[model samples]
Target: MKQAESVSDFYKRLPSHAPTAVPLDNAGIGHINVFSRETCSVVSPYSRRDFYKVSLIIGTGRIYYADKWIEIDRPALLFSNPFVPYSWEAESAEQSGWYCLFTEEFVQHSERMHNLRDSPLFRIGSNPIFFPDQVQLGELSAIFQKMQAEMASSYPHKYDVLRSYLHLIIHEAMRSNPAEHFAAYSNASSRVSALFLELLERQFPIDSPQVNLKLKTPTDYAGALSVHVNHLNRSVKEITGKTTSAHIAARIVSEAKALLQHTDWNISDIAYSLGFEYASYFTLFFKKHSGISPTQLRGVV
Candidate 1:
């Protein structure tokens, strides 16, 4: 899987995009910023985003939602959460609108996080695109305009004000509707978890008995992702609701079952290929998770 685009990468990838703020603040807590899509460029990656985004598109474009597509020829509100993969393309030469990008910590400590995440607009498998009429577009536009104002303001609590504006925008998306693991690091935990998962899954499906599992432990994943084992454990559990060890073991067990059923490879070879030095160890692990020994499951499965 492709690494999700980070905030910095967002700017870098969209060459035509310019920072709406003078100082160009993509740092600090929450790190929310708004910009106009005056001269838009297509971000055709069609992959996950590292942070959350809410876009008010006033131009014609095609949106790449998870496993689907939405063509926007009217003013539309798109609520993009971190989990789902998405992208957009400007079909017309001229594009106009506003969008805001914010990190997980921006709302992590507040109840609004749940509201935003649980709302239909941002929830996975829900419609993320909404077309609001002229009136609703005005209301949404004003909020974004206000965001630009506040972002350019000298007010001490400008961020607090921006947070409210974000909430207002999210609320309107519904009519209703919209990490961790930091501010400076920009969702270090999630990025680490994603990288770890990528590394783990990359070694999968065991093509041959001669090939050995390269990454078979939490420590291996942690080292590959350049995070501490404890950090990896906490981050994986926090995001996936499963510990690192559990994830590794589950993958191993799954591969073992496939090997036992699909191929005639010896149990010892299967064990060695899955990073278990002893066939007995693999059998014990398989039984623990699958409730049956590898031998018993071989023909039965």
Candidate 2:
């Protein structure tokens, strides 16, 4: 039930005197920070983060991604985006990895950034975990090392150089396995389905109490997407094998579970934030989907 960890929270969790030299900008162009696992504190178990993370891991571990648990046995390259909830548990005590955290705005300066959504790194359903051979690992490690060095440097345009390194790392991972890259959709159904999923995911994490979900039903999403409700439902069903309403209900339940478990907010506040007209109605909807009341789920958690 934990909320997503924000960028400021990330820095606060780090040890004092840990490298903290990131550019502060007003344009929402985010800063980048690189760290070796050995030098940083362990992230809390099952906690979610609100930024993008790319890591060159050198030891075995398991990453809980969304509903899937992926085991990593070899040197691996892992990418985590903001939408998916993930946590890492290292299997080896002697774990070592170089990870760089960046925001969506950090990479917007490059043309390749436009294709980021289609890349396995940011794609919702694609596998973000990959095993790399020694050569690939070494190459990736070198990129991280360069990024770390650049971060500590006093050069005026160091960020520009760092952005280039980031692009290099992204391109290297994409090239590592051509077969894993997501292909462009050639059909309208696939395109619509992908867009629908994207739109749905963008409303997630429910990070703040002041923020409320605006799209709650199939008709709402269809209207936003400029499509008939039936057409939207058909496309989502064709691609995902689930009805649009089912998907919406499932997502709402997931968020409800998170809010119940992670926050101190009362049932009424939670229900209102999720677009429920009344707390009783929210309880009924939650119980219908989860087989338990929200309060019960919170107690179990």
Candidate 3:
């Protein structure tokens, strides 16, 4: 597992010709940046990001989202949110498309602030992949091209114009499959399950040594969300097909692997930050979950 990529790191990884003139705000809100897949540099596998991304990928590729692997056999539209960890692996050498990345605050100035996260494009667990037709692909491509041009221009209201273009791409995707995209939770169980997942993902990346995970068990999460532990467990299991504890453990192991591979922290410090009281107990837990010790993984990486 790789450490999550920050927006600044992403900019540094781009090709020499890729523009970086757009200034990012103090809140880490970047003006919309567009890239052509052919020109952009490739990223490592299992890499996670801290920003939102929308891509129109053409050619063959595989998308790893959460635990699911989605194969792209044709032109497709993909949406990735900050909460979900996803990576793209290209199967074919010939790839071409457009992708734009921006932060949640980039669109906050718009009147449709509340609807941004509520939209299917940014919703976790909702299918973010779509196979678009030739005509639809052309339309989406044109919007991205316009955005690319606008991002390079010094127009006074370029950011505002870019917001409309972003919404256009989103609405176009929603229109492609309104039924699936607009599906809403009609029951309390489903809503609770969504909330639990959101709360669970909020404690992720463990980016700093000072930022320790506070929610380690289902009961801890239920207390935070003001729900019964049993009800939370049942809802998570019913909707996700996995127990709440399984999700928590898997996420912890994932973060542990990232920390072990990417950071210089000692094993004891890493263990304590992850909520383990002792280094020996963390070793036992990590070996049980990953079949390897933290030191072993660090050496391999």
List candidate 2 segments past 4 Å from native: 1-6, 15-22, 26-30, 45-50, 60-62, 66-69, 72-74, 89-91, 114-118, 154-157
Order the numbered candidates by TM-score, best leading: 2, 3, 1
Estimate, for each residue in 1-301, the C-alpha lDDT of model 1 and write its tens digit. Answer: 2456787787788755646553334344556778887855655665678788888998898996653578898999888887766668788877899988888877764566645665556655467888888888999999999998998888988877888888887666665322111123348777777667757756755666888899878988888877889999999898889899988887788667656765678999999999989989988888999898888887675
Residue-by-residue lDDT tens digits, candidate 3, 1-301 = 3456767777776546435576656235454677888864454446567778899998797887765679999999999877767778888888899999887678777887445766777876578898888898999999999998988888988888888899899888889777876668878889998898878767866656655689999999999999999999999899889999998898889778867865688898889889998999999999999999999999997
lDDT of 2 by residue, 75-193 (tens): 88888887777778877777787998887777776676755655776787678887877887888889999998988888978878888898888888888767647477868888888
lDDT score, candidate 2, position 285: 98
Per-candidate total of colliding backbone pairs: 2, 1, 0
Winner of 2 and 3 under lDDT: 3
Query: Whole-model Cα lDDT per candidate?
Result: 0.76, 0.79, 0.80
Q: What is the C-alpha RMSD of each candidate to the true structure, in Å?
A: 12.4, 3.2, 3.9
For model 2, what is the alpha-carbon lDDT of residue 122?
70
